[model samples]
Target: MFAFIISRLLQALPVMLTVALLSFAMFAYVGDPVAIMLGQDYTIAQRDQLVADLGLDQPFFVQFMKFVVNAAQGEFGLSYRLSRPVAQLIVERAPATLELALCAAILALAVGVPMGVYTGLYRNSWLSRFFLTFSLIGVSLPTFLIGILLILTFSVWLGWLPSFGRGDTVNIGGWSTGLLTWSGLKALILPSITLGLFQLTLIMRLVRAEMMEVLRTDYIKFARARGLTNRAVHFGHALKNTLVPVITITGLQLGAIIAFAIVTETVFQWPGMGLLFIQSVAVADIPVMSAYLLLIALMFVTINLIVDLLYYAVDPRLRIGRGKGAH
Candidate 1:
């Protein structure tokens, strides 16, 4: 397990470097932040001085090397637009995105798993068909559209929830989260639902497929022949076996949710990394944009590492292999 973990981490190193370098190079063609910031307010010499000061006049390789060194130490430089540390901005706002992602993931698992199990257990039932249809809709509809519809229904027409902003927050260990507060949770509901819709559908389908396959296996058939209750046979045995692949899909989906939440956050003004990323892109804030890309890459790497570690706990075979490999 340790060797496997080390291998995965080692593999991620080049990918991270490539992502950072690509982000840096891409910004060169995305229009200049300095030019946008100055906006006819500065002379040619002043512009040149600003460019030189920012090291933009340096060779691309030289700039990339500087960026890589600084980024390794978590110094993402100052945002041209905000005049603040880009890393600090990301740190402050990351919790909101994390909160949204986590809430959405929990909601997806709670709803999707059981629904999938039921559908898989009774594939031809009318109720199963109904849920399958709903899952189809959930998968088919785009996230921003869902967010708008939710806001229109729950906030605009009903006036039950706020349509925008992180409503209330509490700081813990320098990280502020709105998930813990009543008002914040209420505010969280719409966006979380919007962000989680696709994941919920995806999980439902995966579970249903895995459960159906597991049900046909020898152990499940034997369990049923041994007079075990349908509930115990399905839930206790089949579901447990179905979870290994489900876990892998769920972990990958989580990373995807964070990546795609940018749209949902923008629609709802959720004040998370997505919203911040959009705002940064609009102004050609290279520092923030590059940092955001790198941060997201790091997040994907970290989540995959955690998921890999969890495999040992979930499956005895992997654990046994690890033990043998250690020798």
Candidate 2:
């Protein structure tokens, strides 16, 4: 297990390096970070001074190496716009994004898995068919549109929830979280639902399909023949077997929840990394944008690694096969 984890972490390094290099190249080639830093009012001498100060006048490779070294040490430099350390800014805002992502993932699993199992178990039933139809709709609609629709329905018309912001956070050890507060949970509901709906439908469909397949297997039939209760046969045996794929998909989607929260955050005005990223981009804050990209890529890599580990836990065959392969 330790070896596997080490290997996964090792494998992630080159991918992260490539991502950082490409992102830096994009910033360097596509736009002038120095000009963006100094407005048109700045004289040539002033611009030269600014460029020298920022090391923008250095060779591309040299600059990249310096940036890479600094990044390795957790120093992403200061934000050109806010004039604050990029790491500090991310730290302050990341918890909100993490909180939102976690809420959405939990919501998706809590609702999606059961509905999927039920629909799969009763594939021919009216309720199953109805859910399947709407699940398609959930997949088809855009995330931003869903967020807006949720806002309109729940916040504007019904007035049951707040429209935007994290709301009523409590400070715990330099971290402000809305999860513990009533106002925070209320503010959380609409955005979480909006973010999770597609994932819910996706999980439902996958679970339903997997369940249908598993139910037709010989083990399930034998369990049924052994006079096991329907609930035990279905939920205990079949649903448990179906969870491997469901977990894999759920992990992948959880990554997407964080990566693609840009739209949802924008629509709902949630003060997560996504919104911060948008605000940074508007003013050409290259440090923040680059840091955001690198951090998000690293996040995806970490989630995938965690999912790979989970595959070993849930499926003994994986552990045995890996053990044999290791020899």
Candidate 3:
């Protein structure tokens, strides 16, 4: 296990380097970042000063190396718009995004897995068909559209929830009492649901399919023949066997949650890295944007790595070669 992780770390170096190179080349080739920074008022001389000050006049290679090195040291340079340390800004805002993302993941698991279990257990029955149809609708809708619809229905029409933001501005972090807890949870519900819709749909389909297969296996029949209850035969034997694949789907979707976060953030006015990423692009805050990208990619790769390790632990047969299995 240790060797596997060390190998992954070594492989990650080149992947990350490629990401940096591509991001730098694309940003530099596509836009006049310095002029954007200068805005409309600056003359050619002023633009030159702005470019030089930001070290844009340096060779591209030198600039990229410098940026990469500084980013590794946790200095993501200064934000052009905020005039603050990019790392500091991200650190301050990270929790809000993390909280939102975690909530969405939980929501996906809670709703998706149970529905999937029901569908799988019932097979072609009305309950299964209803859940399958619901999952399809969830998957088909765009997240932004879903978010807006949620806002309209729950906030404007029903007047049950707030339209946007994390919660009350005054107690963004301080609210922990009974009433406030409910308020905070209420505010988060719609956004979390909006963020999780696609993932939930995907998980539902995966779980249902895997469980259907598991139920057909001889071991499940053996468990049933042993006079086990229907619930035990399904949830214990069948669902447990299905979990390895379910975990894989869940881990893969963890990466997707972050990817989808961009759209969801914009829709709900969530003060997450996704919004920061968008704002940075308009003016070309390279360091901030690159750092955000790198961090997200790391989250994705790291989750998959953890899943790989977990899979090995979950089923020892995974370690055996396919050639060995064929024999």
- Stretches of candidate 2 off by over 4 Å are 38-53
> What's the TM-score of each model vs. the native?
0.91, 0.93, 0.85
For each of the candidates, give the backbone clash count.
0, 0, 0
lDDT per model, in order?
A: 0.89, 0.90, 0.81
For each candidate in turn, give its C-alpha RMSD to the true structure in angstroms.
Answer: 2.5, 1.9, 3.9
Which stretches of model 1 miss by more than 4 angstroms? 27-29, 33-59, 320-322
* C-alpha positional error of residue 226 in candidate 3 after TM-score superposition, expressed in Å: 3.1
* Local accuracy of candidate 2 as per-residue lDDT tens digits, 128-220: 999999999899999999988888998899999999998899989978899899999999999998899999999999999999999999999
Which has the better TM-score: candidate 1, or candidate 2?
A: 2
Better of 2 and 3 by TM-score: 2
Order the candidates by lDDT, highest first — what do you get?
Answer: 2, 1, 3
Q: Top model by TM-score, which number?
A: 2
lDDT of 3 by residue, 1-327 (tens): 566689788888887888777766765776677766677787888888888887888998998898678767887666777888988888776766777788899989998998888888888899889888888889999889999999999999999997787774333563222124656667788889999988898889998999889998999999989999998998888888888988988998888887668888888787778888888888778767877877887787789888888887777687775326434
